[model samples]
Target: MATFNVNDIRNDFPILSEKAYGKPLVYFDNAATSQKPKVVIDALVNYYMHDNANIHRGVHFLSQRASEAFDNVREKVRAFINASSEKEIIFVKGTTEAINLVAATYGRKNIGKGDEILISAMEHHSNIVPWQLLCEEKGAVLKVIPMNDKGELLLDKLNTLLTERTKLVSLVHVSNSLGTINPVKHIISLAHQKGIPVLIDGAQSTAHAPIDVQDLDADFFAFSGHKILGPTGVGCLYGKLPLLEEMPPYQGGGEMISSVTFEKTTYNEVPYKFEAGTPNIADVIALGTAIDYWNNLDRPGAVAWEEELLEYATSKISAIPGVRIIGTAEKKAGVLSFVIEGVNAMDAGMYLDTKGVAVRTGQHCTEPVMLRFGVPGTLRASFMFYNTKEEIDCLMENLGKAIQLLQPQTAL
Candidate 1:
């Protein structure tokens, strides 16, 4: 087995040192949210402690410092995603807000009656609902790209779904419910071939994998900072420069306007045109620190380690007599969703919690995927780079006990 310096990584996260129910917290709920590193936390504290001021309008010392910090983070985000220009990156609350921003602005402008927007069967509610609302408002049609039993997108069907009238294709780069990593590069390429734009929901993939928006040729990409070890309420939307420049502003507020008159108003450039109001100034500054943390790590080595944990956990958990894994995609990240026969997913989650194991149980915000599989939901145990095979062992052992406890009751 390849060895990782788990102790050193654990030290970076302050919350990992604490006990959950008297046992050391084995955090498997990373798909939902990741714990903040000390660097990120300290950055947040330092921002408020020294440089708390509104940006872009003031020439005062604190405002200047605050504005510099906020603007610097934009450059950081631009580099992080390898966007062509910093102007293409717009700060929003999270992935949800980012998607809604595009739907309302880009969707409203481009989509009309008979226009189709394509989404995968495995999108989170955040990805799905925004487009649905757009379709409802614009009299546009929403088409779903179906997935196979293994939770992989049916690429063969993609051509049929994408026509000249297909205005947009929004897809998740990685499924939060399943670990399946979709071929977003191919998806983007296909959409571009049809002269259709693509929006990639990178909320799950951004944390586990490296991204290049230009390389993928994605029209729009959105991700949350919290999932990447930064604070919440600070996420980014990356749109192509031309597309961003063409779309109308998502909201009417301060900072998004270039000039305003009694009868006419002109919006700002790409990023500022989308970023309305004061924004999450402190969290945005801290997000740069989080990116720094990710940069410090051996990213490829970390991904390899995570893949090992996923494989080991899958093998161990799938061996249990009644356990059925929900997704068995060949190419996956650090998520493992499963259901044990004779145990309700909620009950299983509660049982694991009592044994000091943390797992998420529910639709995982992808109820359509759950309905397609004909299961209520799976107990989703997602891993991070800091997770260990030992932790997976403990989870597997506790899960077995949980199944044993429920089997007799369920049978009777």
Candidate 2:
């Protein structure tokens, strides 16, 4: 494992010191949501405490301060994703909202009858549902790229699926349920070859990996700030500027309009055109601090350490009797999901919780992937930079106990 100042990193998160069931909290549910660092929390508190004001329309000092803060976050997001310009980054609720915005605006605009939209089998429900809705509404066809048992997409089949009829290809940059890191670069290139645009659901991948949207040439990319240790209700959608300008506004409200005439209303530029109303201002401001926190870290080293944790956790848990490790993708982030034979995933999760080790149990918003694997769900132990090997050891110990308790019932 790469040596890191784990104690120092742990101190940045205040909640990590809390006790759950007399045991210190060991958060392993980072894929669902990460624990906030003190910096992000402080940023949020500071915004509401001092600079809270409605943005864009106000000429007052507080309003100008709030607007600058909010727009500064947009610049931070632009830099975080390496977008061509800040105008491309539209703040939304989260990845789901971003996808829905694209589907409603861009999908509705471009997709037509008999056109096809391709997505992978490993997409989260958020990615899947929006496109499905768009396809239904526009009379377009939804094509799925199949995956192997290893939870990796079949590239060979991807070629066959992409025909001249393909309008767009939306896929996850990383699988939330399986922890598979997809080859989005290749996928984007392939789609571009066919004159099809691509939207990458980057909700899971943004925190763990460095992203360069300009280099990737993706048409759209969406991610949640909360997934990367920022506050909830703050996320970004990065769309190519030309496409964003062409698409209509997602929601009509105060700030999105440039001029309101009784005859016809003029909309704002690319980003403000899509972002309507007062956004999650406090959370949006805090997201900039979250990006700062991530930038301060030794990212490659952190990811390397988390990869060690994944390998160690996988090796230790897989050794337990009747434990089946799922999503054994060669390239993955820090997710470790598995099923314990004869035990309900929820029961296992509950048992682990009693031991003060947090884990996510269920289809993890990817029921289609779960169904593809022929399982109800799996116990998922996802890691982050703050997670330690000792926590993984505790998880392994509790998992053994969980299996032992359920094994007798299975034998009966």
Candidate 3:
């Protein structure tokens, strides 16, 4: 394997070189969204500049070009996750929309009164809320698999949770708040043994590592594009071909119809059936470019580098007095969520921002995680492959200043 160079990789991202607040920017909010590379940005610009047209059913030259580009992304996404076929990849707004699509279409259809949907305690709101709404509507029970103080799920309890009444199991591939990389494959295997289908929220996991949906044998997997260095307003849901063929469309509109008449209407095939109205053509095309960018990288090396960043930041933050690190799970990705003594996380976040250090603060959309840990919120410094140990140092430095500045205010 070639040596991974963070500096060279950083050059690909234009925003990494810029200054903010008259200070060199230290962006540690990768869990929120990743910065785009020049290639992806150029792909977006190139599409609008050259291939700007609505896709599918157009005989015009530009429309054909746009249609081909859009369709090609399905193949790219299929290959990216090692799915069996392009027909399984259904594009949506993001992971939120993707999960909601399943809950609405698959959950609504299959789940009924007294049915149980099992989800982990560490799930993001996107994973939790959709199922909650579905359960409310369907008269189904929503069950949770508990986690320990270290933020690791109790798999022993999972066996009890997987009862005959459990209809579907939805879980997060990685905990965004705690950075715990859940053993999704093992969980998926366990669920399959009981003849239960599993849905994985792969938003955080996909950016950190390569994913093989076939190997996991997940019934459905949802991920966001922006979290993986692609543009926002675009992501995909990868469902099994047979399952997708059986499920009803999430919406009705222009592109998703096979034939529409006064009496009856039919929907298109698996993927197109779910995608309605005009798609995010430009971003979807650019997402293909993002996949291309990720594919070109030394993935193993990149993942290792991110792990190193996580370790380096963890050590630095953990050594500080009066600061407590949350989510000390044995297996984790590139996230370090911590709380400082006598400091409001939001205030700490603001103080750090003035120094041009960008870190996510608060519950991070994981309110249950905060409540479980007995904290209002945390200051999270999430890393990516392009990030350096130097940036971690900058975060630690600014964090100390934030504590000093805010602790006094807390006393007052």
Residue 382 error, candidate 1, Å: 0.4
Please identify model 2 stretches exceeding 4 Å from their true place. Answer: 1-4, 409-412
Clashing pairs in 3: none
Error of 3 at 297 (Å): 0.6
Candidate 2 lDDT over 243-281, as tens digits, reads: 999998999988899999899999988888987888889
Q: Tell me, what's the RMSD of every candidate?
A: 1.9, 1.7, 1.6
lDDT comparing candidate 2 with the true structure: 0.91
Instruction: Report the alpha-carbon TM-score of model 1 versus the true structure.
Output: 0.97
Q: State residue 129's C-alpha deviation in candidate 2, in Å.
A: 0.8
Please identify which of the two predictions, 2 or 3, would achieve the higher lDDT against the true structure: 3
What digit string (tens of lDDT, one per residue) describes model 1 on residues 51-155?
999999999999999999989999999999999899989999999999999999999999999899999999999998998898888889999999999999999
Please report, in order, the local distance difference test score of every candidate based on alpha carbons: 0.91, 0.91, 0.94
